[model samples]
Target: MKLSFYLHKNGAKYAMLTSIGGCISILGYLIYILNPLQLILDKLLTFQPGSLIFKLWTQPPYEVLAKIYIFNVTNSEQFLAGKEKLNLTQTGPYVYQEIVHNSEAIFNENGTLTYKPIRELKFRPELSVEDPDKARIIGPNIPLLGISSYMKNEYGLFMNLGFSSVVNMVKSPSLTNLSVTEYLFGYEDPLVELASTYVPSWIDFTKFGILDRLMSIDNGNTITMHLSTNTTSKDDILYQYSVDIFNGSPGLKQWGYREDIPEENSPCNTVEGAFESGVFPRHLKENTTVRLYRKAFCRSTSMIYENTDYTSSGMKYYNYRIDQNFLSTSEENPENKCFCKNSKKCLPKGFGSLDPCYYGIPIAMSQPHYLNADPEIRKQVIGMNPDQEKHDTVMKLSPELGIPIYARLRMQINLNVSPDQIVTSSKPFQGMILPLFWVELGIYDMPSYLGILINIAAQIPTIEMVTSYILGMIGALMIATVGVCVIRGFNQNRSDVESENQGLESSPFLSIPVQPIIRSEFKLLR
Candidate 1:
């Protein structure tokens, strides 16, 4: 009975260990299958044909203005239009609503996808600064187009106008007569539109031919953007609209990831691919440089660098830059008739110099905060903090998810002025790149699915760690208990043997038994 009990006890312990180990094995397998990377890939690849993720990602989200800062510079030593202008800075809030008129998407035979895009724009004149009209016209002269408001209106641009007028203007405003109505309200010339004139005509949203130009490059609407569907190398996808004007091929890969993130063969340009692959060569902490395509200025390559990294809402990101010096040179983009036609000088890095088509009036572009730009850029422009924290065109993203978390696409519109017969007023100005205003498109609060994805990524590792630790501790405790029980059983058996030997040695019968047995044996023999 005792042996049976011992066997049972040992057997029970062995069974318990086996059961615990089995549970751990099952859990580990589950965790691996549900790993964050696999989960994200599953969702993206297995999307039912018209799912929300499909629509949102393929269409992308719209952005709104969070704030606006105008930079005005003055020379105590010089004057324009015979005015000793006071250098000043103006800041305020702006609002607008984007309207998507039509959109469509289709899967392609090349394992790619295409989308057709149609959108419209509207601005809220109310809930804005007063002198809404004068405030609208700030910037350097675009000749027949306009100038920065600071240069246009010597007085102040802020009127702190009430909301009623703005509401009425937008409530029944005629789309056909936008220019006239806005002009009458002193809101006709938006600073962004002024900035757009300086951008290459192909990428200029303000131009009516934007759609045609985009389609002409590849014979597909801007909405028909080609996207890679292969998930193996999430980093290898390139999504920017191609600039195929010179190549005469299907849209040339002009924008988006130009080279591999780590110089690997994997894709790295598509927004989706980057998220899936976590391969942002530009995101390297080592300050690596990358080349990307730009659709606006005749499909050109931009040399940029990962300057730093940041985090928000549990997501990680890297900051990259297209500073003036880096942008001023690119063999990929030859000087074209539309821009750089005159001096054939590469446009200054930050400023857009597509003045050839705009009546020889040079329009320049820069960042809102002018981060990483020429020192002279901020020096001439007041009200600019020039802090990288505020002004950089930052692309905040998650390294793990390879998706953009938040983005601040910022740029300033400036006009280059010089003494010439075309404009006698600019003669006294010398050669100066005068800033008109800067705007930022702040896109944040990622779609719900993306947030879910990030959370899962964060949670999976935690679950694995916690579960492993707890299971490990339990397993260690069980092993220790079994070992102690085994040691105690061995000690108990040894003690039992010793006690039995002592009892046998202390028996009184055994002391006298030897002599008695000898006498009895002799009598029996007789």
Candidate 2:
């Protein structure tokens, strides 16, 4: 009875332990199937539009650095000898300040999201040079009034000038005097009206096309956007943009493809997928190239105007091509009016041209000081010393989370100058793409919770296995203990029964009272 009671008590505990262990094992398997990216996406959607989380995840974290380049125009003779000389000015490291002019994130009726900015760029007064007098000039030092006028009027080189460069020779006011931040990125919102017309920069966002297409367009429909004049505001032109998206690729609803498609359909379209897959994720075979499209502010020119017509349009669509090796090459060009007609203009690895977008000036784009570009480009220019450590654009990311632990995007600006008989002032600068300035945008270290989340996600498998093993062991031990108790109880009961039987056989009630007394008693009875 004692053994039965003990077994009953332990048996209930064993059954409960078995059930708990089974539950834990099931949970362990589920942990293996956890999708961290999907979880992150779900959490991101919960934040308010203006919340810190929304801004951090949606907007770019660009810390601007203005690296001004100076050309050695003194050696006009060497440049005339088929050699180009350029140098970087030891100018103040101008840090840019930016504030969103309009921080409104509008949700459209079509289920798309749009954000507008008139001129979000501003110079932080506190971080900038305290003395306006001490602030360094941003553009070329040589007076180009005659040359600029000649290009503008005679060559029909009418185009807006980037704040970094002056279109006409008039000295621009001090950085403090210019109201640089008052303008809207787009004069009017593109999505406000569903019209298919082009919008200029003063009234519109110059680069909004990229953002719009990224979040608003349908898959089969090509993205179209107008180009903003970097400097000459004489004309407004729009161009067409294109990029192919395969089914199942990670893309927004704007792409109009089914979100439920299998990942094997090829290429990742979403922002997370792009970063994780290195911009183009598909059946990326060796040596194959992929084209990525984005809207950029390009300096416009008259030459491009003549070729493409007032379409000022080509600038709206500039693309960069990259191979599976992650190495990039320059886009193919029929002819770029902004580039030198005589030299090799093909963009090299790490170097892209804004020529298609801007014509009066030839702007070469690359990481700050030509980082990741062919060493020869830097070697030709005097002040262009590429530093692999600081200038290089590096992206170290978590493949699963599609978030970067460290990221840096650096772009250097260089202008090409060739002697043109049409403008005599350009005689000194012949066959040279002078380095003007470069900017850097960096992001490092994720939010604490995000970091913690990544860590927990990484350890989940181990946690599952360990917990399941421990519970399984406990359950097995409980069962073994129950078996041992049952066996011992059975043996004890058997021993007791055997002893009782032996005692019964010896009991006086079952035997004749006396074998010895039996003989005398039996004779008397007879």
Task: Identify the candidate with maximal TM-score.
Answer: 1
lDDT of 2 by residue, 1-526 (tens): 6557656767777667657656655554444466444455445533346654446534534332332222223344454454665334434344444322323445444322334432234444565433333433333421232223224333433331321144223342211111112111112322212112342431122232211221222122222111111133221111111111222223432222245764523232232112111112111222322233332422111101101111121111111222212224523332222232222445555555554333223445666666666676667666666776666544433332323444455556555443342333344444445565555544443456766544554444466567656655665665566567678877877787788899999998889666779788889999
Off by over 4 Å in 2: 1-87, 97-133, 137-294, 297-351, 371-381, 444-446, 468-526
Candidate 1 local lDDT, 1-526, one digit each (tens):
4435665778777667757766765655555555655555546534236664455544555343433444434443344434654254654544433333324555656544444444443555674554333454333323322232123222222321222233233342111122222322223233334446654452244432211222233322333333433355433333322221222223222222233342322121222211111123212333433333333233232335464454455544555554345333234323222233234355444555534323233455566555555676566545556766666665554544444566565666565653222223334443556655555656645567767765565455666666666665666666666667767777787778788899999999778768888999999999
Tell me how many clashing residue pairs each candidate has: 30, 23
TM-score of each: 0.60, 0.54
Instruction: Supply the TM-score for candidate 2.
Output: 0.54
